[model samples]
Target: MNRDPLPPLTAFPPVPFDAPGRTSPVAGAPTLSQLGDAARAMVPYLREQARNTELERRVSQKSTDMFREAGFFKLMQPARFGGYEYGFTAFIEIISELARGCASSAWGCSLGAIHQWAVSTFPEQAQQDVWGENPYAIMCGSYAPAGKAEKVDGGYTVQGEWHWASNVDNSEWALLGVVFPPNEDGTSPGAGFVLVPRKDWRIEDNWHVVGQAGTGSKTVAIDQPVFVPAHRRLTFAEASSNNPPGASVNTNPIYRIPFLSAVPVCLASPMLGNAQGAIEVFEELCGSRVTRGAVAGGGNRLSQFFPVQSRLAEAYASVDAARLLLYRDTTEVEKMAASHTIIDVPTRIRNRRDHAFSTRLCHQAVEGLFSSVGGAGLSLDQPLQRMWRDANMMARHISLNWDAVSSMVGQYHLGLEPKGQY
Candidate 1:
């Protein structure tokens, strides 16, 4: 891809929302640390509703409302648009904190909040369309390029179905992936996402699963082609890089972060929380649980046993390591983005590799401690079982697959271009 010199970003003029001395409800523009505290505060409510959320097959409106009020949806949004304008590390930390309460809720909210960051990457007009009338409009997306669009006079006519569109039921807009027909020159056009309003399409309600059930990741279909303005479409090639078209206007350094590194970091960061949650639940249970039919002592406390002690120690170490990797890599990438230094292929590859590897560590830690939970943990009511399921399901995501990412990392080290998404 050829690079262009980015024009100096003309600052957005001060508007009513940009009052100089105004204090927000949370007091001024909330900091990332404050956002994290808010996320942590929601854990009890999220944990209490985990089962009900699964039964509904979507996150509850109350939870969504809590997140919205907590300034989570604005964490990475532009300051001119009532957002915090924080970086990737803040995003990861907030998401992980929420995941510890409920993986599905965390995943749902993460995608919704992240799309706000993504919308900031579109053309200024498109950004205005989304946030002008309503700055808090959260967006959900389906990244698979399953829809077909035909180029027209003003824009493209989009049609077809998209699957696993998480948080769609609650969102006002959607970022849907599409394949465009060939140009007049006969060369194939690039794949991209079409930003469609909720009115343009309908939900298909097909998300039925044993894990992450509350994410509401259902299929959304558009029966007939809807005319989407040119400004609404963003190509993958542009999105996967640091220099997207929206950067010309938005001009925030956080938006300059590479897509591959940014997306996987947010997607996989929740697993760290899931693992930590499982450990906490297990340790809590261990405090009260007693071993049955003990060989030496009759009905000794589970925590007193040597096996339990060793497993807890190992699991703690694994989870700690995973958290460290996520924070270290994301912070480094954020610094590079802020400094306007291009993140090289090696660093991007390492980010991808470590993300998957870290997720694997989380999965192993959760699963390893699961066996010690015994029959009590087998019940659907048990938080440990739910955490295990959530962690396992998270590991199955295409971006978090260990073998695929590891292969890409290996290939890169051998002087070959990464053969996998990176």
Candidate 2:
């Protein structure tokens, strides 16, 4: 099939970065450092837009356009589709930097970008269906098996309401999760995703929340059954096996990575940024902040207090530790993929363990920082309070939740069959 040519690489607007050695030879292709610098450059603008984003309950179209122009969304997309095909480590750095400005915006961007890689795991026809005409089209997803699919002649009839599809407002398609019924032999195909275009599904506005409100993680519904071709479906088994159908075409080591080995990083990276941002805000405030003696201390600088100093150190340590774990696991997996090595179960589970643990560390970092902020940090105008709320929300995700992942890890170590996704 003849597809329309993509826009010239030079058509992407250049993002201003003052740092030296940040340029890329390829017009639209961004080096990791350049991408990180671009994300850092957007911080002030994102912070300025933070409150309004929360109030509006969605990342502004302007912000989305800026991200697209910067080439962040193409980081993990297949090179065939004009993506940079960067690894998960690069994704971690860019997303964490964005989260330092606004967790919700970073999250919306994270999901949007990650789905590009996810979609690349489907059959070649499915990949073409999505990006053939519009290579820039992005997808939003709801991964729980909340939808039903009935097998038909050439495809399946799908219907359900998928909840918490982040960045749905800006997406052209959705990956809705569904489970296929067992075959005549009673062998089950298990849970998987079905690709549906925006025309087939409707977005429901119901994303009210105290944290990460700007993400606009709403519900996607198909009231009537929609026919989804078989090629558009990717089973959990195929994706986890690290040799999905798209691997034959994309051939990128990134696409060969097991789904659980790295995808959870998408959930953890935002919290990592939230905590780091909180630490920065707290340190800046402590430098000149003098305590008012409502009870005892009046003139002492907040930074002078032993407790405040300790808290700052603790927060920094926690965030640093989380980043290292995330980077270590992600990079290791990428290297394994590059070597065409089979990612063993132990390695995969260990990565999952780090994903949850790293998120917990980030959450703790923000919590400790928020604790010292006292009444001053409680104000709605303060970004610390928002970061605290956002970190809490990020940790609550099922994939990043400490209790769930820890239990799964424990089950494996104890020789019992692990029950959770890995």
Error of 1 at 148 (Å): 1.8
Give one digit per residue, the lDDT tens place, for model 1 in 1-422.
98898986422111122111122222388755566678989999999999899889999999999999998888878877888777666777788889889999999899988898889888889999999999989988998789888889989999898998998888999999999788789987578888999998999989999888999999888999899999998887788678887888876677877778767877787898888888889989999987676467548887887878898888888887787777777777766776788977778888898899999999999988998877878988888998988888889888898987898889888988879876
Give per-model TM-scores: 0.91, 0.93
Local accuracy by lDDT, each model: 0.83, 0.88
Best candidate (score: lDDT): 2
lDDT of 2: 0.88
- Residue-by-residue lDDT tens digits, candidate 2, 1-422: 99999865331122232211122223568678788899999998998899999999998899999999999999888878898888788888889899999999999999999999999999999999999999999999999999879999888999989999999999999998999878769999899999999999998999999999999999999999999998999999999997989999987778899899999888899888888888888988898678886656678778887888898888878888888888878878877888889999999999999999999998988888888867888888999999988888889999999999999999999999999999
What pairs collide in candidate 1?
none
